[model samples]
Target: MPEGIEARLQEFDRKLRDGHFELLRQFLAKDYFGYSPGPGEPAASDRITDLVTDLKAALPDLTVAFDNIAVDAEGNATAEVTVQGTHKNELWGVPGSGDAVGWTGPVSIRAIGDRFAVRLDDLATPQRVGLVRQLRLVNPADEMDQPPHFPVVWPEFLLRLVFTGEVGDRPCSHLDQITVSDPPVSVCEQCVESDHIWPALRMCLVCGFVGCCDTSTNRHMAQHYQETGHCIFRSIRDDEGWIWCYEDDAFFDKAMLDRVG
Candidate 1:
């Protein structure tokens, strides 16, 4: 590591130790993105600042020690940090347990020119989960139950291709490739034939066939799935942006739906 980078890390420690948050912001890149695991987007400066302030209020004696700092030639660095604190107040909607906890976790930082952006890996360990539960960040019942299905999916190969493009193993339906049906086909094509109304509509990724969603009276989408074995469908309504796979029982964000359409 360059002496300058090491010095910067030391300065970061000092600023955090003194609760100099505004001073810390001066060291971060303007477009910083940080990863946080629970319920929010990756952290930017404002988000991290808010979290730090809330944590400080809840744990007045909180302190951290950074170790195993490793910097690459490209100005990216990572470290493991040991954190100790006492739960003393409400945080993230959870009332404090009034207990002291200590843990170690990893942190990563990337430098853009002289400024840096940081990401913290707050994985859900038993201790961390317990702490968050006590803090009310999550419902205790939901935490104790089986976790829901994974919410995000990005296939490893062909990741560079835009999702709306033709890069998936499944061939695009001839109708989809030709032109999307005008007016977005708000009604399910099959439901109209059966003289039934559907609550929602789903479009087949492979064939652009509009079918009623599973909740609809007819469940045309499931029928389509059974008959044609077309695995993926997207909500035709503009309100939702998720694609579902019947075979995998998985959901994909539109950006990762390249394989289907």
Candidate 2:
């Protein structure tokens, strides 16, 4: 709603369209940092410029259409943008097949006078990465020192254990697979990397992505929730039978979930 905020965003969009990387510097705060979902410091402004440059080089017709711009009382702005371009060169190790690629994602930026501090949406980059994976353009890089897969620790599968019987009408879609697999998969699928320790684990039934518990040092389960938008995760710990919906912020009984399997 602020006129100056809208003007600044439009200016940034123009810079992106024209490949005016130098001009973009003027719009960024001196202490600007861009964030993705990771356990590292947010990337500097230069990094984003570099990414834009690379994308422009690969897709000469690259253009962005911004929509749903919302500016709060604090002059913080969020926008949903759709980027479209024809793939003409390799990106992220994916060879271009001369196809048109378009993806929609969100962006957040803070206005400080004429400059803004951008926090790049955490899901956008991964959505693009996963798109490349889905196209089969490149093989997944080999994982090193892979940890064991799930179900290895349980010697005997317990079929009758139920954590709670009261789900209170919450939509629990995660329990569908429980009828087929007594304990679901064995290890945390995402924590199989080396040197990762987890106090507990849960599995997302919607996608089978395993993330470490909230108490873990990395708290990868929460990260997984943010990245995938999958709302439910079931306890994978020994003899545990509870399921949680991240969106609802409520606990549910495994019995009430839809049996999709």
Candidate with the greatest lDDT versus the true structure:
1
TM-scores for every candidate against the unseen true structure: 0.49, 0.45
Summarize candidate 1's per-residue lDDT along 1-261 as a digit string, tens digits: 566787787787777656675665677654443322222322245545555566778888877667788887766788876666888876544566788867666667776556666655544345344434444443354323222122212221111112211112222233233233223576777767877765557888777788876645678889988999877777775645556667654443454334333
Model 2 Cα displacement at 68 (Å)?
Answer: 1.8
Compared with the true structure, all predictions reach lDDT values of 0.56, 0.56
- Name the weakest run of 10 consecutive residues (lDDT summed) in model 2: 155-164
TM-score of 1: 0.49
Model 2 clash pairs are 149-187, 150-186, 150-187, 151-186, 176-259, 176-260
Model 2, residue 161: what's the lDDT? 10
> In model 2, what is the error at residue 226, expressed in angstroms?
19
Model 2 C-alpha lDDT per residue in residues 1-261, reported as the tens digit of each score: 478888878877777666565675677664342222122322234444555566677677877656778888778888876667888876544556677878666667677668776643644334534433332332333321122222222111111111111112234444443323233566655566656766567787677677777656577778988988777777776466557777764454454443322
